[model samples]
Target: MHTDLWNTCLHLYARPGVERACLNLQSQGLDVCLLLCAAWLEQRGVRCDDARLKQLSDCAEPWQREVVQPLRHLRTQWREASAHDEALGALRGQIKALELEAERTVLRRLESLTQSWPSDQSQGDCDWLQRMASLAGQPDCGALQTLRAAINRA
Candidate 1:
């Protein structure tokens, strides 16, 4: 199982449809870091327990909410203006870098939090998806299923 959370995320996200699925879920208020962690845990065969899920969520939520999301918002909102304004474009680039750093930090924290978890027998992909969905406040959706499938393929 891949223990490097950031690298694992990059690899998984490079797969077809995975990025779209993640962005869709994120737009719906799902924490992408949490989703990625859930996928990694599932890949590792770690049993998806409530306490573990809560721990991971607690670790990532604050950083994602405070740091990552704001940078993402700024960069995304500036996309059109940035194309026309050099200064705004440069600022957007910085924000994008910061957003990436914030995500990396969160992924690193997640990796540390889960590193000690011993791999167990396969508890199935649906198990982690259900737990993630519960935490994300997302009802069953095609994107969620796609994410689960993409993660396993990763």
Candidate 2:
């Protein structure tokens, strides 16, 4: 398994069905970066608790709202127009890259936030994925299942 959250996300997202599942979950109003971080924390055996959950959410929400979401919205808004205009298409690609970089920045922030947290001390009930998914209002989503299965395989 990848040691870092960014690499883990890249690996997991490339796995069969993972991209689609993640996108589906995103459509349902879940933060894909947060979900990936949850999976990484779970894999690392990090103990989950209310406070940690809040910390992660707090750290991610602002960045997602202020940085990532705006870039994504701009890229998405340009999609149709870009298809018919070469200049717009190039600009959209640039925006897409910026969006990805913004996500990477958030992932780095999350990793740094948890850098001092001990892993492999989690109790059986400390499931970060479940907690995050439930918090995002998708406790029983099939997309969540797909993520779970993918992480398990890893």
Candidate 3:
């Protein structure tokens, strides 16, 4: 599942424009979080859908409600609005706002989930070092060595 999520994140982050890449990553990451949450709810014999989304986010303030519930609505508008339409400007603004909020909410959900079962993360510090080490011919061994020293101290 983590590998699948990493791949999805990578693909989304590798898109053309910076704004588009950020938005895509935000959307894809939120989708993964939503799937995970829905799975957890389903296993407990709970039905998860738009109704559940509203109920879960009901106590949230107006901005939060706008972020969680109107995402689909904004996406639909963004997709349907013609490129030549002047109304596209407003839709784009709303989409960007919702994207930012969704990213924040998904990050919070990920933090909570990680706190709950952090041991389930099988990846280790070495994985990061190995990936970084493979990136260049003359890598910054100093940084890597410092990291290793810190780990040893821990």
Candidate 4:
């Protein structure tokens, strides 16, 4: 079995600058987990299309917008308070954990979406980064540069 998309994203995001890059992209409304799964699938030569893009969007957005982002935003809002209030810090920590879990749930959905794609290594040279960047509506230079650098490193 291939390494799961969640594990792949976790590993890749740990690479220097990747976490920052992902956060930068995420702040701009791009779904980093879905992008990582797209990279994973494209690496395996899987194809992408509108329907697939919609599926990826459908898979990633609700949880991100509804669950993860709210938890994250609330946690971020507490950052300063957390410094002064141990109780606030603890609550933020728990919310942070829940946010992480919500993200992991999205990653799992992305992984499941790509699992049935045909395994053909030659087909993977797709411009997934460009596709994602374009899909994001506003092209963020830092985020695109980060993804491009990461993909080239592969």
- For lDDT, the strongest prediction is 2
TM-score of 4: 0.90
Sort the candidates on lDDT, descending order: 2, 1, 4, 3
Residue pairs clashing, model 3: none
Could you give candidate 4's per-residue lDDT for residues 67-121 as a string of tens digits?
9888988999999989999999999999999988998999888888778877766
| Candidate 1 residue runs with Cα over 4 Å from true position | 122-126
Backbone clash count for every predicted candidate, in the order shown: 0, 0, 0, 1
- TM per candidate comes to 0.91, 0.96, 0.35, 0.90
Error of 2 at 87 (Å): 0.6
Which TM-score value belongs to model 3?
0.35
* Candidate number with the higher lDDT (1 or 4): 1
Please give, for residues 1-154, the per-residue lDDT of candidate 3 as tens digits: 1223233333333433423423343343223233323323322333333444543333233434456547756666677564667688677777777765675565455434333332323323223322323322333444334433332332
Q: After superposing candidate 2, which stretches have Cα over 4 Å from the reference? A: none
**Which one is best on TM-score?**
2
* Residue ranges of candidate 3 with Cα displaced over 4 Å: 1-30, 35-66, 120-154
Which ten contiguous residues of candidate 2 have the minimum total lDDT? 119-128
- Better model by TM-score, 2 or 4? 2
Pairs in clash, predicted candidate 4: 45-124
Candidate 2 residue-wise lDDT, 34-125, digit = tens: 99999999989888989999999999999999999999999999999999999999999999999999999999999999998888653666
What lDDT, from 0 to 1, does candidate 4 have? 0.79
For model 4, state the Cα shift of residue 80 in Å: 1.1
lDDT per residue for candidate 1 within 1-154, as digits (tens), equals: 4557788899888888889988888888888888888888887888888899889889998898888988898899999999999999999999999998899999999999998898887565447766887776855488888887877676
